[model samples]
Target chain A: MLDSESPTKSPMKTGESATRATTRDRLAAASLWLPVVILSVTATLWSRRLPAELPVEWLGNEGGAFRSTAVFSGITGTFALFAAVAGIIALAGVAATIRPWLVLVAGMVGGSATAAWLVAAGFGLAGEPMPASAVPWMVALVLAAASYGVVPYLLSSRQRRVRLGDAAAGVPLGVGEAGAWFTTIRVRVFGVFAAVSTLAAAVIAVLLVPRDAVGASAAIVALLLVAAGFLVFSRLRVSVDHRGLRVVSSLFRFPIAHVELNRIVSARSAELRAAEWGGWGYRVMPGRTAIVVSGRRGILVERDNGTHFAVTVPNPDLPVALLTTLVSR
Target chain B: MLYKVDPASAVTIADQLAVQVRVAVADGSLAPGTRLPPARELANALSINMHTVLRAYAQLRDDGILEMRQGRGASVRADAAAGTVRLVELADALLAEARKLGVGIPDVLILIQKRGTHA
Candidate 1:
């Protein structure tokens, strides 16, 4: 399964220090999201009352029905925007072996812009202008909170060990030995986000949706719900271990693959498909197509016996380099 | 002694370093504790990315073949000489060269001995 030699181990002292620093940086980056969530919740709860006190008068009454329904939809849209931005910032923070500072900068810019847009949209829908001075501060808070949350997650979840072995013919495989704890925590967190976002969308649809347009609202809400669900699933992650690739999801658990590297033909990313590749959770590209589940890039393996394995991955460059090294050896 | 590195090798900078270090150590050209260039300087000298050099150093360290300190740079480890790959191709090439030159095996051995003693 592997070379006759024992696999190398990272230095204890240096590895610990590097892991700690990485964790600290990720936490700093993730903290940028706190303000965003807080502001969103606060805006949703108090905006109706707050709108009355604004310097600018609220425009057309449009009656209570229109006002209530419009406000509810706007808030849901705002939440969606916030969640998307948060997800982007979090992913960007830990995408590769990027410098902490660079991730921080990217998170701040991305999170703040999206938040600002959301706030502006909210203001327009409410027929009011945003408080100019307050907006930037709110955005800054969101940025800081996001850094704090994301940096630690990155640090704690960093892959520490790997297990090298031969995968079956025609299966592109990676086995990581240690660091399951990190991967577990990550999966749990994403699960929480998914569940929360999904529940929020569901609850809002049930409570605020008008009675007359039940059919239409049901369709709209269902679409939004699906998008929210997929958004959460897309962020799920699992680590490669010696036994196989550990698959962690809110719904189920299993080892995704235990294939060999030599069998892999080519790897690439593709959109989710249900029937051909088992409904979109995370699929190995079937047939001639190696489909990566949610990641932008995937590794594809075509065995000599006409079977295939494909896995969605974050940074194809590093894994690709590692694969090349192994294959050449 | 300085060795030239090919600019367009398919090998990564770290891989190149590992290969060079392994060969040099096996040949006794670079002795243990011999200080090497800083990662930054080596990256600059080779015109490769800094992270590439860092990854190489990390790999070497992981293998217990290289020692790196924050400001002290890198050096050969104390116990790196145990592992070596004997190449039949080089031995055959040398034997063929000696026969072509009409040199006896003992004379070839003596010349090799002289070069080693002088170095």
Candidate 2:
């Protein structure tokens, strides 16, 4: 079961606090969806200004065929795309289920579609033959918007606090007793390495495959990886409370593992090597899962069910001591 | 909030746990109707016997400070604050009266017991 006092709930309480928190959450959601909304509006406006016919397909290097159906479809498609993206963002935000990747995907797809439609509309308005040059600009615009949009959303959402009243108290404790321990760890060196590697790989791929679409797709993949790497490798949060020990990625606040303290048979400090664990972020081998990043010191917890869990943190002594004391008790 | 019990301390774990709970209730750190950690979990965390934790919880329940039911963990009683306040007031008055009369706690207890037995 999940930890009873996990930081998933908003810290803001009822009355004035709740109202202020809700407003802040909504504003954050709006900021995340702003790029998509702006592109959608721009697409709609551009589509209206286009001539009755739109170039659907290029017949040759110099000429292309125009279809009135294509123009209407583009306009309708733009509106539908905006509505769908807006609805998803709104629901995710209000329900507090918003995932960073989901927003990134929405931004990429929405931005790309909007940009494509806008380019075609621009061609229709200018009465110029479709040119190859426009493709690169369109691809670059989409990639840039999608990549940059994720950063602010991720940063803003991390500021949200978890309140005690919002959580279902797992069990009663003696008054004046501490029932939980929580901390977030950021591995700066590893995150930077991962981000740089992703960008380098994207650059190499673009050089190898000169096609506009391929380059754009590669750029999108690279950006997504960089964003995900920043979230996964940069900040890891560990929480131990009455319910269990929860390790989560700070960006998504999604649990990497939730281990019940009762089920833990033993816990001790151990020297962890990335080579032994098959390297990196989160590794699962056989009956063991290891969260290894940077440091070589970690706490190895053996569960009653015969499974093992290890997490490498800078200072594992306190966590190990706490875990050992709890398990032994 | 935080709950802690030092196994190496001179005080019994049960007494330590009970004192902590009483102090928290008296100070309003634990609001009325707040569910407490389960006895089993508390015992595990403190490295003490589950029965010891239960004993502490029972002490609180008897004082009208907590409510416990099977399957549902312990929670602070709705009137626990008022109950705790009254307890403190009576304890202070008793302590002051005993001090003024140069009577020990044992003597006071014996006097009360003698009166109860005769009645």
- Using Cα atoms with residue i matched to residue i, what is each candidate's TM-score against the true structure? 0.24, 0.37
lDDT per residue, candidate 2, A18-84, as tens digits? 2132444444445545545655565567666767775534422232333663544455356436634
Worst 10 residues of 1 chain A by lDDT: A176-185
Model 2 chain B weakest 10-residue run by lDDT: B1-10
lDDT of 1 at A316: 31
User: CA lDDT of B22 in candidate 2?
Assistant: 75
CA-lDDT, candidates in order: 0.45, 0.60
Residues A1-329 of candidate 1 have per-residue lDDT tens digits of 11111222211122223223345445545555554555566567755644332221222233453244345445444544554354445443223322333444544444544454344445645666546666556556545534443443444344421111222221122231111100211234445655676676676667657555546566556756665555545433333322222233423333334455455443222221233343345443223333335533344344456665555554333333333433433
The DockQ-derived docking category for candidate 2 is: incorrect
Worst 10 residues of 1 chain B by lDDT: B82-91
Query: How high is the lDDT of residue A285 in model 1?
Result: 28
